[model samples]
Structures are given as C-alpha cells and as structure tokens.
Target: MIELNVAIKDKYYENSETAVLSQLDFKVNSGEFLAIIGPSGCGKTTLLNMISGLESCVGQHISYSSNSSGNRFKKNDLASDCSKSEYLENEQANRIGYIFQQPRLMPWLTVRENIELVLDPTQFNKIEGLLAEVGLAQKGDYFPSQLSGGMQRRVSIARAFAINPQLLLLDEPFNSLDAPTAGRLRKLLLDLCREKKTTVVFVTHDLQEAIYLADRIIFLSDSPCTIIHESIINFPKPRTESGIAELEFQAKLTRQFPLLLAGKID
Candidate 1:
C-alpha cells in the first residue's frame, strides 16, 4: 500500500502562504491503476513529485508498506539520510519509471541507445523486443530528431518500461498529441501496463482519458488541492474510445462530472 499526507509551501510566493496541498490523504493498492484529475495549476504534478521523491517534505509525507514484509518505509528522511545508490539498494524503496509531459528524449542518441541508457547491462537483450512492442521495430537506429513527435513519445514509453519498474508515474504524457495519436498511445500504455502489472499513477486534466484508463479515478479541487471525489471505474479493461463514447457510458460520466466539479461527492 502507498500512503500520503502532506502540505506544500511555495517559497517564491510568501505573501499568500497557504499550503499548495492543504491535506492529501490517500492510499493506492499494489498493482492498481489510479488516475488523478484536476484543473490546471492544481498541484497535480507536485503530488507526483512528492511520491517519486523528487520533492522533499519535512514531515511524514509519503510511506510505502510492502505486502510481503509488512514493513513501512517512509520518504520524509530519504534525501537527507541516504545517497542515490543506497536508496536504490533499499529493498523497500520502489523502482519508479516516469513519463513526463514531453518525450524528453536525448537528441543526440539513437532510439535504441536512449532506451539502453536506463537499463541494466544484463537486460540489453530486452531492448529490441521492447522497441518492437512499441511499434518501432525497424527504427532503432534513428535519433529523436528523425522520429515524428508521436514516434518519439513511443520511444519514451519503451524507455520507461525498459527499466521494469514497480511503479509508473505519468504526467499528462498525451496532452500535446493530436486526438488519434493520443488514443493510440493510451492503448499502448494500457497494454504495456497490463503486461507488466506495474502500479500506475497518471495525472491528467482530461476526464475521458482518466475514465477510460484508470481502475479508480481521483478528483481534486483547485489548488490547495485535495481529493474531493474518489470513484471506481467499473468499465472493463481493454477499453477503446468508441466504447467509452457510447451514449450510455458518456451519460454516466456526464452526470458525475458536475458533482465532481462541485465537490459534492460523498
């Protein structure tokens, strides 16, 4: 299980010193797909950063309880207490794979090289298979510049999975893509996640995307963001846009969207 309860302060804006995240308390089950939806500038990325250990908090902001050992590991002291290697060596620490809003591929490296850079040397054999899995079978020699934006994002997805992470964090990865490209990427992501059984936390402003991709959806209020609605998506997996756009499914979400926006969820 994953647990988080924290407050965030913006040092640059001291005049209005309210916490960016007033009270965030939630838990994620192992191997679950959880999507967080909120308005822009609502601290969604901040929450992901905290979970990934990119941001530090003074108190007990995040904790991971391993199901096997029943041991709880805290993130509060990570930065100050351990070196990068030590942290990775800790059995309780989660191996994280993050896909940012942009592909962020290395401009100088070939597609294969970029993916290879993050994998263990022993796992080099898996690179070709992953490239093929992402539909870039013959493009391994091409650099980021040679690939289209959508292809580059595919490379990024392949790279993230190359690490064989236990937890995956995605921050609006499809935000800038066109509709058709985004749809394909979403399906690719779902296929990969199901194959790997990785616990996923996806943050996005797109309601349809969240509803289609997640096992459970979390809705947050505008900044000083907090969970206003937590909903289970009963739709079966391997969902497609056509299926989600059906009148019945759309109507169900339409009715819930207003309550979610109004923070009227029980």
Candidate 2:
C-alpha cells in the first residue's frame, strides 16, 4: 500500500553514451492501477527497470511524511533524507512482484513449484489458492511446456501475486496472447488488483488495453523518453473492452491525438 514516485533523471545502457531515458518523472498513487504506453524501443521497459531497481538511476531523491489518514507518503517528496539508490534498495526489496513480457518460467518445474520459488516454505500452502485464482486450479502439476501460452501467462500472474507484493510491475504481461485470451487475462488481472488493492504500474504499447486496466495512463515519447501526456480513466471498474463507453472514449482520444497510438504527440 505504498505510493510510488518515479523520477528518473536519465538511464544509459552499458558502453553507450546516449541516454535511453531522460527526465521521465511521474507518481503512482497508492492502490492506483497505472499504465505506461509508448512506441517500440522507447525506453518503456527501461523505465520499469529503473523503478524496479533492476537498472541504475541517475538521480533519486526520496522521503516520507507522517499522516493521520494512514497514507504516510506522497509522490516525489524531496526531503533529501535518502538517496534514490538507497530508498529503492531498502524499501522495495522482497516486496515487489514483477511480471515480464515473457512468462520466464522454468520448463522443468511444475506450476506450483515455479510459484513456490518466490515464497517461503511455510507459505507453500498458498499455492493452491493462487493457482485457482488465476484459473489454473487443476494445472498445478503441469510444467511450462505443457500449458498453452495464455495458460503459462496465467501461471506467471499467479506467481507474481503469490508474494502479496505491495507494488506490482507488469511489462506488457499479456502482449503476445490472442485477443480473446488477452481480454480474459486482463479481466483476471483487474479482479486480482481489486481484491488485493496492490499498487500497479503496468507497461504496454496497447492504448485500449491500458484504458481497460488502468486508473491512469502515462503516455511517453519515442526515445530519451519523457511523459508526453497522461490520461485519467474515470470509467467505473470492471469495464468491458467492447462497452460503448470504452469505444466512444477511444474514438474521441484518437481524434484529439491523431497520432497518439503511433507514439507521436503531434
């Protein structure tokens, strides 16, 4: 239930001088399901890496203030009490669940075992319920090779939620699945997010998918990425992809930002 404030001054890959990301800053409110969308190779993944502390950040300033409402933190609070590296390292360790573009599962391990890889031995009993939650109740003994792509992704989702992470980061977890399958999984994810109320920052290139799943959407430019726009999805929860409201909103958005889906602000 921690709010995330991401201010990535810059990110440069090894042996390269050009910045893959620059001056990208945003805040993810606690329990807010947020999405990031942009053009291919636009540093979307890089930004997620930085937030998850998988990549180095050029500048990070972190702090928190006490509050009575039980929301003890605010976004980008620069009290200088901790460095960017220090804060991300100390606060996020063992508390983050990251779902990558691929399932990244071990072929030899059973679905139950893959999930157990992240949990304590005592928490092993939670595996059954987690598999059931992701629509894999009967497939716990199946390995990654036996399940379909969508099913494997389900296992991945189950594994991520197994930790009951305070923050969940998804890098286009449903990207490669078919529409029918992807839609089903998106609903599954939405339900889980609601039930857990975990803070989520999902990265994707699909605008419609973002609208369907996120409470707020952050759109980025091509490279040396920065926030070009942010759309707040005011639609009620449990939304449908084909709902008139969802379609109409999309139409209006495309008309307003004609090249938005193309990753162009103009």
Candidate 3:
C-alpha cells in the first residue's frame, strides 16, 4: 500500500508572508484514486505541490510509505527524508509518476523521443512498450505540435509510466480533451494502474470526474486550505456512468458535496 500522512501545517508564498495551505490533515491508501476538489483560489494546486514535494513547506510534514505487490522493483525504496528538489532529481530511481495539467513534452522531440527522455539510456527498449500500452504506438514519429491535445496527454502519461513509479500524481490531466476521449483515457489509465498497482493522487475541480475516478474524495475548503471532508465512494466495481445513476448514491453524494465544500461537515 502507498500511504500519505499530512499533518496540520502552514505554507506561504515566497518573499511575502501569507499562508496558502494551512492546518491540513489527509491520507490516501494504496490502489486508490483520491481526487481533491474545492472552491476557486482554494490553494488546491499548492496542496498538490506540497504532496509532490515540488515546493518547500513549513509547520507540517508530509510522508510517503510504500509496500510491495509481488511485482518486479527496479531499485530500493525511493522514500527518504530528503528535500523536495533532491527527491525530484532521483526520478530515475523512483516509481512515482506525474501527469501535470499540461502535457509538458518538448516540442522539439518526437512522441517516442519525448517518452524516452524520462528513461535512463539503458532503458531505451522500455520506451516502445510504454508507447504501445498507451495506444500511441503509431504516432511515435509525430511531434507534440503535430498531435491532438489528447494524444499529447497520452505521451505524457506514457512517459510518467516508463519508470514504473509507485505513486502517480495528476493535476487535472484530462482538462483539454473531449468527454468521450477523456473517459476512454481514464479507463486506459485505470487499467494500467491496475497492472502496476500504482497509487494515485489526482487533483480536479470536476465533480463528475471525481465521482467516476475516485475511490475516495477529499474536499478542501477555501484559502488557508484544510480537508473538510473525506468521503468514500462505495459503489460496486467496474464503475461507469451507469453506476453513478444510483439515485440514492447520487442524491447522497450530491447533497453532501456542497456541505463538504462549504466546510459545514463534522
């Protein structure tokens, strides 16, 4: 299992003294998709940055712990007591993948080259397999500018999985795609994660997306953000649009979500 323990903490913007994420406590379990949603300007992005250890933080600590699922591991556990920058540098050694809001691939590189960029030179052979897995095998020669937004995102997702990270962090990764395409990609991504048993922590503002993808939904309040609600989605598996049609579940979740966002939950 991959676990996240975030204690009550505070963080501020550089130079100025203003807390962005304050007094937060949250946890995510393995094989789980925990989606976070909140009001505008609620510091959701800042909270994600802290979890990925991309930014410096104070007053609280976020820790990551992982256990095996009987698969091949390339190296020792990447979890460590290191600074954010230092941890980012060890990407090659870690199994934590990230899909940013933007498909931040290099324009100069072809799709294949972009995916291969994250792998060590010795792992070049792994590139083709990852591309095929993401359904981008035929577009290997195309550049980012030549592909549709969905295709570009696929390449990004492929690159993130090339290293087989234990954690996958997504920041509204499907924001640019059409509904059907996004739904397809979501299924593919979920399948891939099931194959690797990767734990995911995703951030999004869409309530439907949250309902469709998350095993648990984490709700954050406005600025000086803190988790106000953590609701488990107990619908039966292989979840689909049809499953969410349960009037009881729909009414219950829909009715409570507003209260959660409003910080009115106990």
TM-score of every prediction relative to native = 0.84, 0.90, 0.86
TM-score of 2: 0.90
135-207 per-residue lDDT for model 3 (tens digits): 9888999989999899898899898888787788998899878998998888888888888878888888777
Candidate 1, residue 6: how far the Cα is off, in Å: 7.8
Off by over 4 Å in 3: 69-93, 242-248, 257-266
Model 1 residue pairs with clashes: none
Q: Which candidate comes out best when scored by lDDT? A: 2
Backbone clash count for every predicted candidate, in the order shown: 0, 0, 3
Q: Candidate 2, residues 16-61: lDDT per residue as tens digits?
A: 9998887877877778899999999999887777666676554553
- So what's the TM-score on candidate 1? 0.84
State how far residue 90 of model 1 sits from its true place (Å). Answer: 4.6
The worst-scoring run of ten residues by lDDT in candidate 2 lies at 59-68
Pairs that collide, model 3: 95-165, 95-166, 96-165
Question: Model 2, stretches more than 4 Å misplaced?
Answer: 61-71, 74-94
Q: What tens digits encode model 1's per-residue C-alpha lDDT throughout 1-266?
A: 33333334331123566677766777777778999988888788878877787765434335554453555554423333355665455434656789999999999999999998988789989999999999999999999999999999999999999988777899999999999999999999999999998888999988788878998988888877778877787768877776734446657766767656543454
Give me the runs in candidate 1 sitting further than 4 Å from their true place. Answer: 1-16, 68-92, 244-250, 256-266
Q: What clash count does candidate 2 reach?
A: 0
lDDT of 1: 0.78
